[model samples]
Target chain A: MRNLFNYIAKYHFFFLFVFLQVISIMLVIQNHHYHRSLFINSSNFLAGNLYDMRNNVVQYFALKSINEQLAQENQALMEKFPESFMKTDQQIFEFRDTLHQKQFRYINAKIINNSVRNRNNYLTINKGSMHGVQPDMGVITTEGVIGIVQNVSRNFSTVMSFLHSETQISAKIKKNNHLGTITWQGYDYQKATMLYIPPHLELARGDTIITSGFSHIFPEGIPIGTIDEFEVKRGDYFFTIEVDLFIDFNQIEYVNIVKNVFRDELTELEQSQ
Target chain B: MEFTALKYFGRFIVIIFIQIMILNHIYFGGYITPYIYPLFILMMPFSIKGWVLLVVAFFSGLTMDMFSNTPGMHSSATVLIAFLRPAVINFISTKKEFETSTEPSFSVMGKTGVFFYVLILIFVHHFSMFLLETFRLDEIGAVFMRSLFSTIASVVVIMLAFLFSGRTKKVRI
Candidate 1:
């Protein structure tokens, strides 16, 4: 017993180092998965507040660009206003047209902290559970799709950005509707790779890629990116196509949280099958 | 003793602020992010106990992870570098002895000594961090590239920091 104690005392530092490394590695593995909830992320109270404070100061510098984006979006929205359309039909139609039911709702949120340099990037938004934000909700901008909400606090949430290595979105080429999965290669912030695209299909440069509505998270036809370059290796069945993403992650300051009203029903029905 | 502890605490806060707030935002070339946070562990007093050093490194890394949303990647890398710091110092400091409680700096270890010290430690920290972040063998090349670029960037920043501080020390003298 004395020998064992002496041995432990002698090599205690090594043991402590190993112990800390094990704990850290375990944390890394645990947080790597999409479903696991972590308490120490930036969305936590203290970090969230700190980021919020920083954003308050830094947001001023970005006001001009934000205004420009908002003006552009406003112009687009103005074109969709009811007054912009002239009613040419002589037949009066009933106001209650039940053809389209609401499938998604948008909640506006300001991003307080965002990182694109990391292999697994996450963005912290100011809106959280109190604002009806929840895990797995899709986040998007007026320009393009952003990410999925992973963790939520009272007034803050962390979004797994599309730039993340593990993030895969169901997307399709707009022209032919050929479906593929979009994934980041951890190299470029402005680009992603589209996989599962067979080499036999005709592809062109600048072909638009949009979200396929197959996943309950995002609505169909949201702009993802455009095809940049593609090549098929000999004997390989899939085309290695690079996409130029529409969203410039560095300049993103505001995002909209997408709440799918029928998500629970859709998921339950799929699971039952 | 209390004053020294307070000074170290202040430095901890300042270094972390610079790391997450300032340096984290500077994403040079979209791939390289210079991490000078490990300089805190590198600058620890020579006589710091092993267990204390390890504990300090773990917390320092954990703090960075909290802000960056990487829970364990920084901690694991920092702990490994902290564990190897003593051996690295001994390997480099042949025929010379550092006074107890003296922190490693440009004035204390000279320019080349500090440069090599920062280079090796920062490279190890960044390589381990990138490896753990990716957690795959297939992309080892990307991990190595990232580590190499980031280490070079971090070494330059840390050396500049040392030079500026050394100048201030001269002024104090």
Candidate 2:
């Protein structure tokens, strides 16, 4: 017993570190499934508001530059020469319009506190529970889905940005109902991967991907991105496709937090089983 | 001691404000969020007990977490860093070698020693943080990439802050 005590006392710090890590892992596992660990999420509205205030000043300056960039892009987009003889370009233009404008609503909220450099990126918004922002609500900018609200306080909410590894949403081929899960690989904010897409489905470069509406997190038809590239799995039936996200999340200023009015009803009905 | 405690508290609040306010807003492709605030922990007096260091680090990170809305993430990471600090310091600098009563700084550890010291701690802190944040090995490659890139950025920021922090002007306690 004395020998054991001596060994433990000598390496107590190592033991403590391991013990703490186990606790952290346990907490993480407990919180993995959404809608259960509401108490500790970033969506606590008051904290969200406070964090937003801290970030507001810096983002304010960034917004000016973003606005300038948008103006330039908007100008270039408007000046595209109308080619008279190509059906592909015409079809592309029409598809782009509907995909960009349809399916999502923009809710303008200032980021009070946000982190992008971390492995798990989250954004805090000035809007909160009072503003109809609720847990699991989808957050998007003019570009694409930024994140989902993980926690909500009365006056502020926290958004789990698509940059987070934990972020995964159901998306499908716009041309067909071929479904896959879009997830952040955590390396780049602008890039995401579409997993479990069947190889049998015809996919092409620049094919549009959109939300399937199977999950209440996002409404159907929200444009996620265009297929940047794709590769067939060596021994599998699906394609691991790279998606060029529509929204440049790093440059996003304003975002809309979507609250499905019938979310509770739908969840209750589904859980009735 | 009481007066010094208040001063440190004030410093803590200021660093967090700067971290969340000015630094967070400057998102360069979201690849960098300046985390110089951790320097506050690095700069604390080395003479302080391990438990005190742990608690202070936890509180400082908790405050930032509260403001950032990431519950327990920052606190947990900071605690780990704090816990490892004593071991690192003992390994890097002997009690006799550290002549100054002031905390770890470039002037104290020299540029090269300071770099390695901060690099080790920042690497540990970022590794734990990213692992906790991701909580999955599914995208381990990407998570590692982000961890490396973000660690480099955070190190740059933390180093600059420490180098610029200079000697604390003696305030009468």
Candidate 3:
């Protein structure tokens, strides 16, 4: 025991370094998924409260833009007012729209924290489990999709942004329905890479891409981006394409957390397979 | 002795406050965040034990990570730099024996010594942080560019901090 003590005393610094380094690396590995490590993230109580305080001060600066967005939405809603209907249904036809099933419900939230520069970027929203937010719920702005909910605490949550390297969002070309995946190249926030697109399709510079809805996270027909550039991948059948995202993540303030009502049902049905 | 301890504690709080509240917001083209919190680590008294220093570094980095929403990236980098600091100091110092309760600063080490000290530590910290943040073999060039820019920015911030503290301004040769 004395010999062991002597050895440790002799190499105390080295041991300390190794010990700390291991802990740090363990933290990094544990936080890689982030979904299960909610408390370690900024969404935790103390961090979340600090950010909330900061956001309270910062939110005022973005008031003009937020007001504009709200005003625009209000104007759109006002246009759909019952008084605006050309024909007042004297014979009130019992009309429940059969076209939409209300599978996706949205919970409004504000982003308290955001990052776009890193390889794996994430955003923290004020809403969490208490606000009906859960992991795998889709987060979106008025413009387009922002990201998917990664970790959720009681009053806060972290979203793995679409800009992350691991997030290969399933998207398809709007014109011919050419299936492709959208991924960030960790460079330009406005630009992203579109993969699995066949070279056979005649690609245009401004081709629209929307979510395929195959992942059950986002609904179909949600506009993701427009093709900014494209090129044939050498020796491969796929095209190396670049897209300009409709949603600017840096300026995103308000978001809607989408809860798919039938997600569990769908998952259960798939699990049986 | 109590006053000095309280002063250091206050400095720790102030530094952490500025880092989270102000410095974290200064996102230089989204690639660099000027991190000067390591200045606290660098300014520790020479008599501080290895384990204590490591603990301080961990907490300092963990604080930054908490605010920045980056879990372990900063902590790992800071701890690595803290671990390397003793060796670097030993290698650079002309005198083998060190005085007790002496904090590292421009006043203690003079201009050249302090410059090299800050340069090496800041560069290593930034490089490790960027590498860990990216964690991709393909973006080696990106990592280098980011680290370089961030190191330059952080070094400037650290120098400003030193000057602002009246650590170097009054002792100008």
Candidate 4:
């Protein structure tokens, strides 16, 4: 016991190092496994507002590009107006008042901070719980799918970006409705991999992959990306296809958090069963 | 002594500010992430206790992790470097002691010593960080590539930071 005491006393620094390292590793594993490290994440007010201040300065240089994207989106929205299309096809469809219920509501937020390098990258947005952002809500941009909200604080939220390796979204081929999973390979930001697709089905370059609403995290029919390249793996039953994502993560400045009103009801029903 | 402590405290805040505010956002093709926070840990006064140093390193890293949304990657890496710092200094320094109240930086450590020291620690930190990130042996290639590229970038940035860290005059506490 005396020898043990002396040993510990002598190498206490080493012990401390090991102890701290172990705790840190535990934190990392815990975060990876459960993603419950909420306060430690970037969604906290301190980190969030720091990003806000930085974005305030950086947004100026990006104003021109942001204006261009806004204009493009404005034009797209403008084209959807009732006046833009001819009335010839409108007469065939009968419309009833009070028949439509709002399914998805968008809450706009600026991407104050974003990263694509980490294996588990996160994006910090300026909106959060107070602003109607919450976990599992789908985030999107004018171009395409951005990511899903991982966590939220009172004033800010963090998104699990599509670039992350563990980020797997339920997607399907827009043409044939063949289901697949869209995931990042921890290599490219613009490109992601769509796996679990049957080889028998004909797939072509430029085939569009969109959210299938199978997971209910995202609304159906939101465009994700297009097929860039694909190959049949040896001794595998699926095609290894590469997809080019529509949203350029590096250039993204603003996004919309989707609030699906029926998500709670769907989850409650599913869980009760 | 109080004056020196205040100066170190100032450095701590400044370094953390720069890291969280500016450096964390600078993403260069997902290959290089320049981590300059380790410099603050490296330049600590030699008189600090081992446990205290470890705690400080952990806290510093935790703050960075909070900002970057990396739960423990930064803290773990910083602790590893901090744990080995004294040993590295003892082995490499030509002088037995680092002089009273002298900051362990480029001007004080000399160019060659700083370069050699930063190179090893930065690589070790980056490699360990990447290893912990992947948590698998299959990505050794990726681990080495990222660590190497990131270490080079971090070394350059840290050296420049040290050289221009307002070493003009001593400010009283």
Docking class of 1: medium
Ranked by DockQ from best down, the candidates are 1, 4, 3, 2
- The TM-scores of chain A alone, one per candidate, are 0.94, 0.74, 0.91, 0.93
lDDT of each residue in A39-106, candidate 1, tens digit only: 87888999999999989999999999999988998999998877777878774456855358878899
Q: Write the per-residue lDDT of candidate 2 for residues B1-173, one digit (tens) a residue.
A: 89988989898878887886667556555565556777788878877766677767767766666655455667778888888887888788764556535788776777877888888888888777767667777766766676677778888888777756753332322
Q: What DockQ does each prediction reach against the true complex?
A: 0.78, 0.33, 0.67, 0.71
Residue range B1-173, candidate 1, lDDT tens digits: 99988988998999999988789999788778999899889989999999999999999999988898888999999999999999999988896898997888877888889999899999999999999999889999989999999999999999888888778878989
- Model 3: fraction of native contacts: 0.66
Cα lDDT tens digits for candidate 3, B1-173: 79977987898999998888888778786678898899999888888888889988988898887766677888999999899998888877877567877877666777777778889999999889888777777898988988899889999889877766654546664
Q: By the DockQ metric, which is better: model 1 or model 4? A: 1
Model 2, span A125-220: residue lDDT tens: 788767767677888655577788877777777777788767789999999888899988665777899999877777899999998878887887
Best by DockQ: 1
What residue pairs clash in candidate 3, if any at all? Answer: none
Model 3 lDDT tens row, A1-273: 999999999998889888888887777777766455545678889889888999999999999998988899999999877666677648545475635877888899999988887778888899989988999999887688899998888999988888887787888999999788888888788988999988878989998999998889997788988998899867888998888889888888889988889999999999999
Off by over 4 Å in 4: A1-7, A89-99, B28-30, B94-97, B106-108, B165-173
Of the two candidates 2 and 3, the one with more favorable TM-score, higher being better, is 3
Candidate 4 CA-lDDT value: 0.85
lDDT of 4 by residue, B51-84 (tens): 8889889999898889878788889998998898
